[model samples]
Target: MKLKKRIFTILALIAVAIGVGSVCNTPNTAQAKGVPTVFPKNMRGTWYQYYTDGVEKDLSKVKITKTTYILGEYTPKVIHKYIPHDKPDFERADWIFIPGYQKQRGITWLNVKQWNEPAGIGIPDTGDDGEDGGWGENGGEFFNVSKLKGHQVLSIANTIDGTSIHNTSHWYRSVKLAKKLNKRHYKGFLY
Candidate 1:
């Protein structure tokens, strides 16, 4: 009788284990339902330029123009003029853009004329006069170019200590604008 009781207990435990396994293997119902997808569009065009100088400059004094251009599969060359008030306002450069591929990163290039412009007033205060000299002593600001879309580019940059930095310009789509700038000889491919 004890052996028969043991056999019944083993069968009961095995049945419970099988039932639990089936329940665990069931698929989630939520994932089986459908869902929608959305993709983002690119932003490219001629945009006004703005400079920030902390609290010293008024936000209203910023100047802008609609003369920028977007270069596709070619080099963008341009002559830029800068106005100096509290700081320099413009820079000339070449820009290039390459699209991204599957599992691969995109490509971009920028050749800035005066890549490092100086900052600081001519005075070094009372303590650090020896260590302070105007221009090229502390290095210049940093700039970067990124693809916003097929016909657009975004420039991200910052100053020496990484403050008052912002997006500076947007190039409008113009195939003719690329030719007038005159390429200064560059040999490279963006793949």
Candidate 2:
């Protein structure tokens, strides 16, 4: 009986050691405190972006030039489950990540009508009341990421308005910018 008890104790210790080893080998995705794993200081600045050819359609009516806001230090992990307007019930979580950036994990619908896709109407640089437009083929929209020293500008030319429309999606970082937009921001997922 004593021998059996001793064997049991030895087995328990081995199990515990194995369990600890497995846990130690597990990878942690969360950022460590005080460690700048993402969004290094150099990344915070104003930037100007253009198409691959450094040219884009003229969108004067949309007026996206004056838009400035802060982007989150960490890239959000986004999970997209597209709900088609004209198809059977189907859902899928699209895992998206920016190469050499942070993870984005949220599903958001891009309203097409409010999008400045056409070439006549105008949209405010920041607000909730722009013409809605549909999402792109991948249910995503593209924005030019320009940096400007504590402020970032995302410019998208409104094909419909013949102007650049600023999407104030980052106004929540401060108070002054929020007041300018009447406390309303664009509805695009950051994380």
What's the lDDT for candidate 1?
0.32
For model 2, residues 115-151, the per-residue Cα lDDT tens digits are 2212322232454657334222222233333443345
1-191, model 1: which lDDT tens digit per residue?
99999999999999999999998887688455322111112322332223234445211111112322333323343323432334443342241111111111233322122312334532232554443321332222222334343434334232233223322333323434332221211222121
- Give the TM-scores of the predictions, in the order they appear: 0.21, 0.25
Once superposed on the true structure, which residue ranges of model 2 sit more than 4 Å away at CA? 25-27, 30-57, 60-79, 82-146, 155-191
lDDT of 2: 0.32
lDDT of 2 at 18: 100
